[model samples]
Target: MSLSSSVEFPARFSYACFRLTPHSVYAINATILPQKCRLSTILTAPSFDELFPDALVNPSRPSDLHSDPFWAPTLSVDLSDASGIWIHLGKAPAAQCDKLLINVYKEYSNDSSRVSFLETLEVKCPETAVKWENQRAGKYLLTAYVPIRGCKFLCDSADKHCRQCLRTHLSLEIRENRASFIWLALHTMKDHSYEIFIISAVLVGLIMLVMCMGMVYALWKQRRDAKRVQEIQLTMYVKAMLIYADDCVEHRNCMRMLVECLRHCATCEPVFDMEKLLQPDSVIPSRWLIDQIATLPKFIIVISECGSRILDTTESRTHHLVQARPFADLFGPAMEMIIRDATHNLIASKRKYCIVRLPYSPEVPANLAVLNFPVFNLPDQFGQLTAFLHDFENIDQLNISQPLSQSRMTSFREAVRLQMTFFEQNPDWLDTRWRPIDEPAIPQIREQRLPVEISTDEDRIAAAKLYGIDPPRADSEDEETGVGPSNERQFMLHPPANEPDSDTDDDDLSTSEDEIDDEDEEGGEMHTVVFRPDNLF
Candidate 1:
């Protein structure tokens, strides 16, 4: 009885039986291989001269199996020492095939060159699988059968027969069934080392592909996060404050132009929004300026004639804008406190402020004399401003370029009083004259009740009455509606000619009709003016 066993293996691992065991064989074959399979055999062990003497009966080893005429006429099967028969099949045949057979014989005796078979099992090609007991460590004779036309061709199973098994040529033809037969007797085993090497190469390739893909994704994510962080940094805004005078038309126009120019500075616009302060209808407060100065990076002040006058002037001050020289001096001690309170830290000049002065008026002082403060003029290339803005970080406590001059300083309350007086007299000038109607209204200057000892002119005195100040009633100035100081002689105060008598009433009529007539001839009105010695003295 003959047994035949044909098992499918991976094409890449063709003769690599040990490297790719039965477990890995199915996984690679089912997923990667095609329907067609290519097969090559390897033989090893005892030499064929001692095993099959029929093929070389004339004492000559045949190099080619097809050298025989009977092996021709059909497929030419090469029986080599290193490589045996090669087969290509489109699809596997059924498990049971009468034409293909395999015979397995277990060797029982330990012999030097000859042995006898004990147990035998006949396997029908691939259909009926033969299970041999003690297959772990044993010697066996296994022969494979293939169909050749209507005949059977026999070949030894590689690596199955060992030293204990007898090397013998067995040709079996049952019931004279042979039409034509080609038999490879006692085929030796062959170890195809190159096939095992090919399987290892494929596994390494798959691992490298997965690692490359992971590296690519990681690099892409790193770049994406870096780009997002850069964008956030570019668009962030830096705190800033703007200072300017709006006392005259040219000053206002220059400041408006500057504010618009700053708005057009695209890079700096993200860092500062000075445009809001210059908005026509914006009513910015005096404290708002201080607040911003206490908390922002850049402070821009337009140096002009109006600014110079206020800084120089000590006696009279504007209604809304306090003299900076005096205000700074008045709050010199509180400056550090105010700055510390606003920022919650000690003052850091570089981080807290970067002052820029624009000379709107050519008459600006040769030196603003502010220490550590730099003035930037309007450059021919406006783009430089945007570049300059990047130097300063956001902070509180910004000082304008112009420093407080050494002069007679007033208290904050006194400065406020002076501002109130000017605004009271010229309220419209503060609110309506400079800016457009649609713009934000200017902050109303808060009115302060000043001591009457500081007497204003008669016009201011009359304006004061509207603000609840009680003034002495006029006597002769009434009844005549349009009577005012004539162009002939200016109104003058004259001292009394004679001291009043102690017996006379204080309200007695002192002026005679003859003196009034003489004064009428002289083209001067006779007037009795009572002066307050408390104010004049």
Candidate 2:
């Protein structure tokens, strides 16, 4: 008998990416524990080439049946995840021809693998299978199987890029019969290497992507936390602030409201003289204020049309406004302290002082405005002010009422209405008046001489001014138009009780008047001019 032996070998529990075996090895689940199977380490006797020789000699015919033999034509078949491949032996002859042969073998798709089929098995191909197995064959064993150690498998599939089993070829022959048949045959199961490579690349890319994202987030978080810690480390004390404002009714109200808000916020201590700001005629408590100015962290000057007016150095300290400003006394001391501390103190001058402009207020001091202090126009820059006052990283202590209560909101609305009304009334309330100035008095006196051509009093006075001589004192008894010194009566000097009252002013002149009657009438004219009681110079 021509030698033929059955051989069996064990398979690995599961295949990984290790692509191929001698026969079709398809696994549904690689991790599942395999059933107990008897194993053999022994390989096939000799090898595949020696057993299935190219030459066959027929004993009955006495002819050499060798060289290339005709193989039956086969239909295309694929065996992946093997349900087992069908070999359709189409239209067999009506008479029994000879012994039929079924064969299976495998080799690597690429030429790189010189190692042959590495394992084997002896189990015969099942003739029929359950419905799910989908076996399709009529009579002859329609499927071929082999122990992996033996050889042969095909290279062609529709997908050309896939690994092909080295153009595996199949052959069949019949003895003492005329053989005419068609059949189906399969090469090998697909190893899925190309698809697996792509999937693994995508999976690796996804894992790397996740790792990169996580690293980026970690770096960002670390930076943010470090910055916050540094800020906290450098934080200064919240400190204190002093408010300087005008005597305006609305301004005072707003200042008081701000004071209240600052009180609510634990951020900074507000140092303000409520008494001086509130009272109708309060003066500065200079003695007490000395103690207050000892520490100065922040100083807020509330600016408004009214505040600007009050803060004016020369204008606000005028006669009327000086009394009008309730904080007049306080302003002087406060300003003196600020200027003293601020002089050459850059922090005190620039940083410590802040100017805030409320709505509907425009007046600003020329000197103060020139200082270029940080100006916050509110309620817009209110948040900026809070940030400015805060020193701690997480401590947001300067919380002005954001969502105010209804009552407080109503009050704020009312204040807004008042401010709008004030806006409507322009600069009419500003006092533009200044103090009056005066110089010493001096009278313009005429010349002490007159012209002789003068007849009337006007002419005589004119002539007196021109000639630089005395004019007649005898003109009007009621008015003194004369230029000469006349003997007018002295209230201290009185005529003797015995003597008659006379027009002469001098007691000695009365005696001279009697002597004048004895002189010429021309002398009488000079005499008359000198003795008139109405004459005054």
Candidate 3:
């Protein structure tokens, strides 16, 4: 039999082994000697009923303690020639038996099973005794009953001391070879630690994944809303200027679709190409054609292959000018001159042309491609053309937007059919007999020397007389009556208060009052002038 129990040190130590014993002769003691086995504690001796509590034998009913694994006891013997028995207990702590008391029993009379009290011993165990170096795993034998050899004060009665020491040894080694409960608990905790770590890492990874997805979705939504707002604004600013074939035979399908698309726009106006109107049978004066070209704002021009061919035809060219007769009649030659000047200004600078190239024709002339005029190669669909004209600037310049609405497409097709019918019935309406021949090309003249350099005063007098204004004399008494010296001889002349200028009913001057002149005065101020018949001189 062996006495055993376990103690756990804090985590600083990897593993520790110890041997302990009681010092006094009157005390029972248990010691942990070094061994090669798992760490365990030794259990002290007790009656069979106390050791296996569930298997107690009753006189009325028999019980079997040998059948159960927990109640069974195995014994081993040591080959060493020692007089005392060897009690091996696994790595039990020495401190379990500290101040523990035990009683030894003896059998008497004829009943061998009966027992009586033999001796009572107090066990005095130390906190720590023998410490081992290695953590070797094997069994260990703890000789629980080691008798004290020398006793100074108690040795006066040698016989009494001998008997007491024998009795204490008997009490100490009553139990043998027990296991430690603490080692089992330590193994169980280590197993659960790995599972806990894995569970926590998985939870954290899932949370990060969800956050990333939400961030991406929010960014995508914000950009979508911004694009929608731009679409609405672009649609409102859309205006179309259509140039189509009048023949109604070639490209009739495309031409009708073009008209339908143009009608859907807030403003759809026809523009007559100057090249087309330079035909023999043309009735439109050059001035009428010029006025129509000058009043244009930001406009989209859709040209089909057939319409392009029509402009290059003599018959169609003549028809365009004749159709423009009504415009010339209403605005007259004066308005026509204003238009001619504006067109000439645009043609000279060639900076403000806004031309869009259709996907229908790649052979369109390079002359049509002017500065700052973007070219788009659109798809053949009408609805796509409408959407492209709406937001062409804000869209990706490389690709065309194809948001085809079926309803708009159907309506446009129907509108084109009606337009073709009107054109067929009114074929001769624009073909009036007022055909005018083209004017001769402007004659170039060599620069001639003037007999005398015209003085500033002479320029002022000439301009004043041309506008029928009697300019204030330089020797005038009132400074207000005379033109400022800085403004003298400028292209523009303000009417004098003393003499009312003749009213010139020219269309050129009618709309030119607000036109700012680029010519600067000597004082660096811009001269705001209306174009009168004198400016043409």
Candidate 4:
């Protein structure tokens, strides 16, 4: 039958029915015919129910009549060309097609009849022939029909064919033209999620960076403060060492270490050059010693008594070395003379010079007097030693002869006066002078000339005046006691014999008392008194 022909099928349609299995279904329905048709026409009609079934039919009623007016109306003109339609069915329904023929027609009158009906039967029963001929051909062909200009249908027994067909068509459409929209949606979601991730990552990184920077800065500041403290401590230690270098020659190691610390300190802070302190050619040691003493710092000289004795021996050697040099000329005359006298006294008396003692004691032995001048102490001694060094250092520039000519004599006399003054001020020193017993007395000598032959009164007067006495008198009370004007001047002015010679004896006793009084006034006591007589022949 031509696919486009509308046909009416007999209501007495019948066919061998097959049971529906779980995988298949069967559909049978009816529709009102709009035209008269013959049996041949029924045979020639396309499978209209398969091709165009109303989708509103109840799903539970596989065989119920579809009575809704919409279902009863003649199928509308085929819309296959305007909207493509597909149908699907499973196996079991095709074997029951003969009992389920349906009539499909259009609602139109003959007044406008331009259509013609023609019938011709052609059976494409290849599957039926193979089944009957072989009886073992298990594969079966379900019938399918399609109007030339209408929808397609399958006559298999599957009940979900329509849904399957619709699903397949939708899948095809999605695959063909909607792919870009789906991809765009997916990319947008990914972009949003990525943006959030990046923002979070950046925030976390910034926070960590800030924390790390803060930690680094704090550590740097701590180290800086520690370094500053160390520098201050080092500077103070060096200053202390410098001050102690005086009077503590054993602290040379401490001073050297302090200098080393100062060198290191200068690396981290502002300090003077420390290398100058250690220069071999410099007088830094001596200068530093002087400076240390000037600062009023004390050095502890820990001398055991035994050590003191050894030091004394060493000091003697040092003095001998000092004296053997010509540097004494650099000292003032007073100091020079005193040093010379002290040396002479030491040699003559075979006594140790107290000045040569190492570690001068505050009080010396009574026999060994300490010079009370400042120059006798260690500081002044060092000053003199340094002065000698200065002179030695500039020996070429000194004019020895010029100083001797201009000031040496005056300085020598002044030095004598100084010694006298020192002795006078300290009588204890003079009292210690050694004296000898049996000291020889001064002799009295007589004039060899004939006692000036005082034969005249002028001569007698001259002799009396020369001797610091009164002139002899003749016939005076002086002659009544057998006193004579003799050439001997002693008896000439003798006390009157009548006075019992008490004046002469008393005068001699008074002179001896005056001598003793004078000795007492000079701050010395005579251990023994000696008598001397002025005698006459």
- Specify the highest-lDDT model's number: 2
Evaluate model 2: give its lDDT: 0.44
TM-score of each: 0.24, 0.32, 0.25, 0.15
lDDT (tens digit, per residue) of candidate 4 on 138-208: 11112222122111234345654332111000001101111245565665577598887889899999999
Decide which is better by lDDT, 1 or 4: 1
Clashes of each: 22, 16, 16, 3
User: Which portions of model 4 show Cα errors greater than 4 Å?
Assistant: 1-252, 260-537
The local distance difference test score of model 3 is 0.38
User: Candidate 2 — number of clashing residue pairs?
Assistant: 16
lDDT of 1 by residue, 1-537 (tens): 111234453255445453322111122222225746432232222233322234534446565755221111111111111222221111122112343333444444465244454544443434334333322123444444333333324335563432222221222112112121222111111234466568777878888888889899888976666455322232654434445554543334444454545554323442222344345665444454465555666555445434444343341233234322212221222233333443553244433433344422444443333334344554232333444355533212222221112231122223334444555666575334333324544455655565444444464345334432223333433324545443211122333553333333324322432465478789986554443322331
Better of 3 and 4 by TM-score: 3
TM-score head-to-head 1 vs 4, winner = 1
Question: For model 2, where is the 10-residue window of minimal lDDT?
Answer: 39-48
- Colliding residue pairs in candidate 4: 15-99, 90-157, 90-158
Would you list the rank order by lDDT, best first?
A: 2, 3, 1, 4
Predicted candidate 2 versus true structure: per-residue lDDT over 497-526, tens digit per residue: 323233334444445444555664555433
Supply the TM-score for candidate 3. Answer: 0.25
